[model samples]
Target: MGTSWSLQAVAPPAGTGGGVQAALDRVVAQMSQWQAVSDLSRFNRAPPGEWHGIPAEFAEVVAAGIDIGTASGGAFSLAMGELSEAWGFGAAGPVDTLPDFMVPSDGGIDLDRDARRIRRSKGALLDLSGIAKGYGVDLAADWLLANGVRHFLIEVGGELRGEGIRPDGHPWWVDVEVPPSWAGAGWRIALHDLSIATSGDYRRGLAVDGQHYSHSFDPRTGRPIANGVRSVTVVHRRCMMADGWATALTVLGADAAIALADEKELAACVLANGREYVSRAWREMLG
Candidate 1:
């Protein structure tokens, strides 16, 4: 997403506070060290059948991504790495000239559940950008909690997670960025112990022959979704759930998102045709 991020924790006393900052700094550094897509990424070279000995925090994220992918009927795939690379969404440089969209064939990937290992046919790359930011947010929040900070908000890119209460005892407040359609609307949400993520075609888009191509690609078709829906925001107890659900809902469109949210009792907001459709669960939480 390349969006900015800032981490906040409950203010601590003079001498005690420094340790919390140091801990957060260390966590951020560790996250950067394990980033699979960065220039110094280590996960890319992980040997097949090897667990990579990732921190528990990172492993939980991988497991959650797999679950969300299964829930979305593969709409949220991590195995579309090659497709992303071809479209210049990978570490590779931008496609000097974008190619016309073509449906890609899926390479059947094998995930070793107990081992937490992954194997794919050659050319299969794992793309975690969609879910990793939320995972990072969760890690930041965990870091705060472990350091004795209870009331806090932590975000990576645009994903946010908050817990306990603010120093003033009010819920943490956040706003879903109303797209161009919902302009002139003031809609900040008060949240506590909830993570929220919004996926929109508005960010990181490419234009080809006057058509906007979203960064989100459908794994089944290997093409940016043509759905008219503008944005999907999912709120849940875990940042990973909110992040992955938001992406899946973007691919599924408004009605499916509403239905799924209702079935799962999830908090969701969908934007279509300049109108917003929110789930009752979300409404209840907002209230």
Candidate 2:
């Protein structure tokens, strides 16, 4: 997680701010791909076909990643670590040529929940950059609540989760930013015990040979998605789900993304081809 994070909670007993910062730091240390000694990095470097034990938090995130990937039909995959690095999005920076690697099948990586162990069958690279920040937000929220702060809002990067009302007795409000490429009044939503995450091409991308490559990659093509969809936002009770869904929908583009959002009954907004599409569930939430 190479992004800024903020936590706003009902004033906790004095001197508790350090505890929140420590908890967030732990999440970064455990999951950041940029950190050489992170749990995820060690797991990625581990020899294939060998069962490696991981921390409970790492296991939980990986489990959630696999579940979301399956549900999104591979639109969201943790196995794109190599692809990300090849495209210069990872710590390795950009390479002159894309790495030669076979895309991992859905079941290429196996996780044993009971044993907290994982093994990869085909040397698949694991990258959790897309969802790790959201998980961090959730972890921070839980820390605040457990430490006697019930009203709080947690945001890492652009992913956010909020619950309860502020000390002023108002629900947490967030303004969804409009993509720079689009023209419109920004949308605002009152978040109460719900989380929202947004994905956009304008945020992080690489330009090569006079063409732009987004960080969001389509697993099917093993390349950056060039879909006309510029952004996707999803709201869910859990920030992690919203984060993953936003990225998945962005890769799926507008039509398919909206269709899947409806199929899953998710509250989502997709900005594509100079148009905005809101899922039925999102409209219901707005109302």
Best by TM-score: 2
lDDT of prediction 1 = 0.70
**RMSD for each model, in Å, please?**
3.4, 2.0
The alpha-carbon lDDT assigned to residue 151 of candidate 2 equals 86
User: What digit string (tens of lDDT, one per residue) describes model 1 on residues 182-263?
Assistant: 6546358766888999998887666767777888887778888877778898888888789988988888778877887888
TM agreement with the true structure for every prediction: 0.84, 0.94
Best by lDDT: 2
Which segments of candidate 2 are over 4 A away from where they belong?
94-107
Q: lDDT for model 2, on a 0 to 1 scale? A: 0.84
The C-alpha stretches of model 1 lying farther than 4 A from their native spots are 1-3, 13-55, 181-186
